[model samples]
Target: MTPDATLAARVTVDLDALAANWRALDELSGGTASAVVKADAYGLGAARVAPALARAGARRFFVALPDEGAALRAVLGPGPEICILGGFAPADIAVFRDHALVPVLNSAAQARAWFAAMPGAPAGLQVDSGMNRLGMEADELAGLLPLPPSVGFVMSHLACADEPEHPLNARQLGDFRALTDGLGLPRSLAATGGILLGRAFRFDFTRPGVGIYGGAPFAESRPVVTLEVPVIQLRDVAPGEAVGYGATWTADRPARIATIAAGYADGILRAAGAGGLAAFHAGRRLPGAGRVSMDLITLDVTGCAEIGPGTMVEILGPSQGVDQLAAAAGTIGYEILTSLGSRYSRRYTGG
Candidate 1:
C-alpha cells in the first residue's frame, strides 16, 4: 500500500500556464470563456485546475456528469456557475439542485424532467447541429423555442472545427444559428477548436477544454504538463540481445539501455511504444526498445548525453509533448492526459 520512497516519476502541472491558457482562449473567444473541467479537469486534477481557471476569470465551468459538477461546486463555492453537459434522469436532479449546478438540457425529456423537478432553476439548452452525438435533434428543438424563462444559454458543439475547412463547421454554425436565433440567450458554439475557427463561431460564450491543457488544434497554447519518469536501472546489451517483453527489440550493435519505472500501466500507451517513442534526458532523445511492459519500459540510451539509475527522464515536456505522444500512440492529446497514471506523484507549480 505504500509507494517507494525512491520513486521520482512525478506529473508536474504548471498552474501558471493553465491560467494563461484560459486567458489565451478567452481572448480568442471575444466573449466570456467557460472552462470545461470535466473528467477531473481531463485527469489533471479538477480540484486544482478549476480554481486556477476561476482565478483566470472563468465565470462558468462545464462538466460531463453530475458527480463532477458536485465536486466542482464544492471547489467553486457559490459564485462561478457549474453546468453539467450530460443531461440527468429524475433521480439525478436532487444532486443538481443541492449543488446549485446547472444542467444543459440535451433532450426534451431531460428538459421536461428538469423543469418538473425544479421549475424556476436555471438551465441551458444544447441543440444537435450535426454531430448527432448529444443534444436535441433539430425537429425536437423547434418545439421548445423561445425557451423557458430560466434558460440561461443555447449551445451546440462543432463536429469538424479542428479541420477548419470541414463543411460540417459551417453547416453546424448555420444550423445552430437557425435554431437559436432571436432567443437572446447566451450562445456558445466553440470549444478550443471552434475558438480557432474565427470570431463568428465565438457567439456569446465559449467553453474550451483540451487547449487549456496544452493540446493541439489550439497550437498557440503553452504546454501545461510535464511527465518525468525515473530510470530504475541501466545495463549494457550486446549485439543480437533483446530488451523488454516479447523480445521485440534487439540491439543490432552493442547498446546501453535504461529501464524506466513507468510503462503502459503508467499511461504511456503501448501503441506509442510500439511506434518507437523516446524519452528525454539532458536534451538527448532515447528511443524506447521492445515492448512497454505493465510497469516498466526499456529505452535505448546508447548515445544519450547523460543518464543513470535515479536520473529523471522526461516522457512529456518541451522535447516531447502530449500531442507528440498521442501521435506516436495513434490517439489524441485528451486521451494521453486523461490516461496519465495515478501512480505518479503529482506536483502542481505556479498558480
Candidate 2:
C-alpha cells in the first residue's frame, strides 16, 4: 500500500540524496568510505538504507551491536563487510561467525576472545584515542598481542572533530598515529566530522554516519529525510482560550490551531514544543502551540487557515531541516535522527 494513502504520519527517505552525501563525504575522505548503518541506519531503517548505501559504492558498513550486524547482513547479503562497534560477547560470537560479521575489538580480552573464537575470521581493532567511551585505552595497548592475519583495520574515534579547532582533534589524531603507525594495517580515525577535518584525520577509511543521513557537522550535505505529518483536526480559539496540556499557551487574540497525528511518541521531541517550533504547508509556516503530547502536536495555524484535516504539514523538510528542529529541541542531529519512531509509515524515494 502507498504511504500517503494512509492517514498515519510518514517519513520519506531520499536515497539519492543520501548517496550524494556519501559521495561528497567520500570525496572529502580521499580514502575508503564506510557507511555507518548502526542504530538501524540511525533509525531510518537498515533493511532499506543498507542496500541504498551498497548501491552507492559502500563496501563496508558499521553497526553498533552484534545483532544489528546480523540484521544488516540479512539485507546486504555476503559481499559487503559488516563491522560491529559494540564489541562482542562469548554468547553472541556464533552469530558473528554465522553472518561473517567482524567485531571491532575494543579491549585485549575482546581481541583474545575474537581471535580464539574465530582465528581465521576478519576483525578490526579500536584504540581509545581520546573518547575513552569504547576502544582500548593507550596504556592498555602495550600489552596487546600483534594483529592477527584476519585483522582488517585499526581504528580510533575523535571526540572533538566537530569543533574543528578543539585541541582533542589533533591530540586524538596524533595518538591514533602513534599507536597504529608503521603497523602496515589499514588505519581509520574519522567519522563525519573527522572527514571534514581533512586528510590528516582521514587515515585509510572514513565512516560517515549522520552526514550520509543528512545531518551536521556535514553542513554541505543535502537533506535526506522529509517527515510529513497529517493534520487530523483544526479549530478556532477565543482570545483568552488556552491550548493543549499544562495550559501553557493562551491566545492573546483569536487563533486557528491544528492538531497533527503524530507527537513525541513519534520522535517529535517534547522540548521542541516549548518555543519557535513550526510545521510547514505549501511553504507557509504553522507555529507550534503548547506542549507536545504523547501522540499529538498542536500548531498555531492562524496564518494557515486554509490548511485542514488530511492536509500534510511538513515537520522536517526544506522549510524545517532536521538540524533546525533539533536545535529547537535542545538536542543534536544524531539524537533527532536516531530517536525517529517506527509508528510513522516510511517511504523510500529516489534511487
Candidate 3:
C-alpha cells in the first residue's frame, strides 16, 4: 500500500536515543557538545529533531548553509548559537545577521566580503587543518585576521578522526591546538569521531552531526533513527521465477516474496539489493530480492513463517547498521541519512 496522499507514513525517530546519544557525546567530549543539524537533520525531519535537541539542553547548533540556519532558527527559536559550516555568500549577509546566525569564515575573500557586507557581525573562523574543504589558509589567517573580538571561536575540520587511531588524528589535533591556543577564541575540533579519539581533541565545544541521529561515525553511540516499512504484498513464486523489474533473482525453490514501498527515489539505493538483508517479525532475516525500484523494493520471505501483509519490517537499527547499508550502496552514513526520501510517513518517539 502506498503512503496516504494526505498523511505521510510514520518514520519513527527515537528522541530518547537522540538525547542519550547527545549526553554520551557530551561526556565523551568532557561535557562540551554542540550539534550539527544540517540536511534536514540528515533527512530525519529536522523540524522535529532540532527542538528535541534543544529540550535536551543543547545550546549550540550547526548547519551547512545560510538557508538551513535560517530555517533552524525558525524551529529552534532564539538563545542558541547557530553556525553555518559553509562560508557566507554576500547574499546571506543580511539574512545571517537578522537571524542571529554566525558564519564560519572559510576564505580570505569570504572574510573580507562578510565584513564589508555586515560589519561587526558575530562570526566564527574555520581553519583548514587537513580537509582542504572549507576554511581559511594557515598562512592567510596570520596576515588577514585582526584577532578581533567579533570572532567567536577558531575551528578546524578533522579528516582522519573517523579511524580513531589514524596518525592524522594527532596531527590535526596538535595543529588545531597549536594554532588556536592563547588566541583568546573559544575552540572546537571534534566531530563525532574526534570525541572517540580521547579527550585531547575535545576543546571548548564538540559538534556532532551523525551520532546524535543514530548514524554511527563512532560505535560507542546508540541508534536514533529506525526505518521500519510495512509489508504490502506477499506472493508465492515457482522455481526460476525472476523477481522485480530487472529479473535479477531467480527462485531456486518455491519462494515467498514481499514488496515494500521504498526505493531508490526514497534514498534506498538500487545497489542495496546486492546481497543485503532485511529484518522482520521479531528479527527474521530476509534477503533483498531483485532490484530496488523507484517506489518499491522486494524481499525474499520464503523462510518467514506466519508473515504476511501489514507486518512491519525494519530496514535499519538493531538488526543492521547504516554503515553496512552504505557499504552495500557504495556510500556513507552521511549520504544515506541526507538522501532519505521524503515520502515516508514519520513518527517521533519520546520527548
Candidate 4:
C-alpha cells in the first residue's frame, strides 16, 4: 500500500482554500485584513497556514500569546505585523520587543506596563465595549485619554457579531464607537462575524480567524479540511449481541461491523457516538454501532459492497464538514478543529 493509504487516519488541509477564504474576507473588509494564527491557526498548523496566508497578501497576524507570536516571527521571518491579543506581562516584554510583536493592551494596568517598559513602541489598544471578557472598560479608557503616539490602533471584539441580529451587536457597536469615534487612530472592531455584519463594523482593519479556517459565520468560505480513517477490521455480529463499553449498542439483527482505527483519542469527541454520528463509505452512510473508544470505533457497515480491512472511512470530508461534526459532538467547530489529535498523518495541498 502507499504510505498514506497505510496510515490509520489522515487530515488533509487545503491551503489554497484557506488563502481564498482570507482573500474573500479581505475583500469584504473594505480595508486591511489581518490573519489570526492563534491556537496554531485554530489547530491547523500555523507554521504552514501563516506562510500561505502571507503569500496571499496578508500583512498582519494575531496570536493569543507572546510565545506564539515569537514562533510565528521565526517562521514568517519579519516584515509582517504579529499582534498579541492576550496582552502581556512585564516578563513578556522581552519576547514582544525581540520579535517586534504588538500587544493589544487590554487594561489600564497592561497599558501602563507596556508604556513604562517599551515607550514609543508600537502597540494596540483594546476597549472592552461590552464583552466584559477583556480590554479596558469605557471608564478605564476615559482615564487614559490622549493615547501615546506609540499606540498604533484601537480595537474591540464583538460579542454577538455572529448572530448579526443580536441586539448586543448594535449595542457593542455603539459602545465601541462611543469609546473610539474621535480617537483618530486606526481602529478595528470586527473578526469574521463582525466583517459579515457589514461595512459599518469593518473599521480600518478586520481580523479573520475561524472563518478563514472554514468554520461558521463565513458560510460562503470554501471548505479547507478533510479527515479519513482506515477500517482495520470487519466482523459479523449476531442479533442480541451487545457492543462496546456499557453495552450501549446491541445488534437487532445480523450486522456487518467495521472497526475503524480512530476514536476520542484522535479528536473524535466521545459525545458524538451518542449523537447519532455516522461514517461514510462510497456515499453510503453507516451509522455508528457503539461508543467511541480510545483508539477505535465500530460502525454498522452492513450491505456495503467491497468493504474490508484497510478500507478508508470518511469522518470529516465532503459529506460532513467540521460544523456538522461539531453539531454531532454537541460542541462548536472551533473545539472540533482545535481538538484534532496529532496522530493523524497530515497532508497539505494547493497552497
Candidate 5:
C-alpha cells in the first residue's frame, strides 16, 4: 500500500535538492568537495544519499566508523573513495582492507598500528589542531615523521568555523599550517562551516556534511526533507478544558485539537511543545497546544478549517525548515536531522 493510505508519518527526501546543495558548495570550495555521509547521511539513509551525491560529482565520501564505510562500499561499488573519520582500530583492520576503506589516523598509536599492519595502504592523517576531541596532537606528529606515500592527505577540524569571527578559527588554521606545511601532502581543514569561512580554509578538499542535507551554515541550501504526520483525530473542547497528558494547555474559548501520529519516539523533541512550535495545514500555522507525549502530539487547530482526521500536517517543509523546528526544540539542526526516527515511511524523489 502507498504511504499516504496509512496513518504512518512520512519523510520525503529531495535528492535533486541534495545534489544541488553539493554543487553549490563545490563551486564555493575552490577545490574538490567531498560528502560526509556518516550517521547514515545524518539519519536520512546514506545508501540512497551517497549514490545521489556520487552522481552529483562527489568522488570522495566520509563516514564515522569502519562498519559504515563497509556498508557504503557495498552500495557505492568500487569507484568512489570512502574514508573513515573514526581513526584506526586493530579490530577493524580486516574490514578496512576488505572494503578498501581509508582510515584517518587520529593518533600516534593508531598511526603506528595502521602503518605496521598495512604498510602501503591508502590512509589519511587527522591532526588535532584546536578541536582536541580527536586527531593527533602536534607533539604526537613528531613521532610519525616522514609519513609514508600511502598517507595521501592531512586534515584537521575547526571548532569555530560556524562562528567566523571566533579567535579559534585563526589559531587552528595557523596550527594546521605549521603542522602540515612543507610536508607536501594534500590538506583539508574545512567542512560546511569552514567552506563558508572562505578559500583559505578550503585546502585540497572541503567535506560538507549537514549543509548538503539541508541544514544551516549554508543558508542558501535548498530544502531537501519534508516531514508530514497524519492527524489521527480531531476533537472540540469547551472553554477552560485541558488537552494532552499533563493538562498543561487549556482552551480559552472553544477549540479544535488535532492529535497527530508522531511524537518524541518519532524524533519530535518533547521540549518543542513547551511553546512556539507549530504544525502547518494549507499554509496556516496551527500552534502546538500541550505536552508532547511518547506517541502523539496535540495541535491547536481551531482556526484551520480544512484540518481534520487523516489530514497530513506538515512538520518540516517550506513552511518550516529543519533549523526552525530545531530552534523550537532548543537544539541544533544536526540533532533534528540525525534524530529522525525509522518509523516514518520514507520516500525519495529527483535524484
Candidate 6:
C-alpha cells in the first residue's frame, strides 16, 4: 500500500520477529509454546499473527473472548482450538457453541451452566494462579467440580513470572500444582513470564502471549518488535523558536527539525516527546525536539542534513526496539505493542 493513502500514520507488524520470538519461547518451553493472540495479537492483527504463529509450528492459541476466538478461528482456518480466556458471559453460551469455541470455565456457575444444559462441547478450566485476573478460585474448585467430557486444555495465569525469583512464583506454582496434579488433562499454567520461570511451569501446553510478538515475555527476552515512522516536513528553527503545543520546547540552538508523522493518537505516547527518544536514519542519530503533538513529533536534525521529508525514522524496530520505546514512554513494551494502531501499511517480514 502507498504510504500517502494512509491517514498520516502506519503500523507495521514484524511477523518475522514474531515467529522468531515464538520459536525462542517454544524452545524455552521445551517446544510447547501455544501463543496467546488475544487483543488482535496485541493490536498487530490476530488473523495474520495467529496463522503466522501456526506456521512457526504453534498448534494451540488463546483469545480472551468468544468473539476473539471466533475471529481467530476464522483466521486460522476453522480447526485449531481457541481457548476463550474470558470464559463466558451469561448471554454468550450460544455464541461459544456456535463458534466451536472453548470457554475456560472460571466459575462453578459457568461450569454448571455449561454441563447441565449444553451436554457436550470442548471446554477448559482456568485456575487463578497469583494473577487473580481470571480463573477459578481454589476454595471454589474443591466442591466436586463439573467438567465437560471434552476438557481439551486446562490453564492458569502467572502474575509474577517476569520476576523469576519472586516468592509468588513458587507460591503460585505450589498452588497450581496442588490443584492440577495428575488431572489427566492438558494443563497450561504459564504465560510468557511463566515460561521463563522454568520447565516446572511448562505443562503439556504453554501459552506465551506477549513474548511471541516480542514484548519480553521473560525478563531477559530479546526484543521482537521494531517500528518505524517517516519524516514529513523538515525546516530550520531559530534557537528561541517554540515547538509543538503549549510551546513546551524551545530550540537550544539554530536547529534543522524534521517532523515525524506519529503521536499519542497514533499510539506513540505523549511521554515519548519528553526528551525520551532519539530518531535516526541509516546510522546517524537525531534528537527528538519539542513536545509530541497529536499527529506529529519534532526531531532536532541539525547535523544530519541528509534526512528530510519522506526519510523513514525508526519508531520501534531493529534500530529502536520496544524496550527503548517503553523506556521512552515510561511504560512497558507490552503496553506499547498492544496499543499500536492499525492504520499502517503493515508488512510481514521473515516467515
* Candidate topping TM-score: 5
lDDT of 2: 0.88
TM-score of 3: 0.94
Off by over 4 Å in 3: 1-9
Clashes of each: 0, 0, 9, 0, 0, 7
Q: Top model by lDDT, which number?
A: 5
**How do the residues 48-125 of candidate 2 rate in per-residue lDDT, one tens digit apiece?**
989988998999999999989989999889999999998878899789989999899899898888778887889888
- The candidate, 2 or 3, that scores higher on TM-score is 2
Candidate 1: tens digits of C-alpha lDDT, residues 32-132: 79999989999899999999999889999999999999999888899899999997788987798899999999999889888889988999999899899
Full-model lDDT for every candidate = 0.89, 0.88, 0.81, 0.92, 0.93, 0.77
Model 6 lowest lDDT segment of ten: 1-10
- What is residue 224's positional error in candidate 3, in angstroms? 1.4
**Model 5, residue 328: C-alpha shift (Å):** 0.5
lDDT value, residue 350 of candidate 2: 84
Residue 201, candidate 2: alpha-carbon lDDT: 87
For candidate 3, write residues 1-351 as lDDT tens digits: 335322223467888888889888887877789888988888888798888888888998999989899999999888999989997898777779889999999888888888788778888899888777877767878877566678888899899877877888888877777767678888988889887777788888899888887776777668777787777789999998899887888999999998877788888888777746455557667778898888888888887876667777778777776787788887788887887777887788997
Total residue pair clashes for candidate 5: 0
Which is the winner by lDDT between candidate 4 and candidate 5? 5
* Between candidates 3 and 4, the lDDT winner: 4
Better-scoring candidate (TM-score), 3 or 4: 4
lDDT of candidate model 5 versus the reference: 0.93
Off by over 4 Å in 4: 1-7
Clashes by residue pair, model 6: 10-344, 11-344, 226-316, 226-317, 227-315, 227-316, 227-317
How do the predictions measure up, each by TM-score? 0.97, 0.97, 0.94, 0.97, 0.98, 0.92
Evaluate model 4: give its TM-score: 0.97
- TM for candidate 5 is 0.98
Expressed as tens digits, the lDDT of each residue in 220-292 for candidate 5 is 9999999999998889999999998889998999999899999999889999999478999888888999988
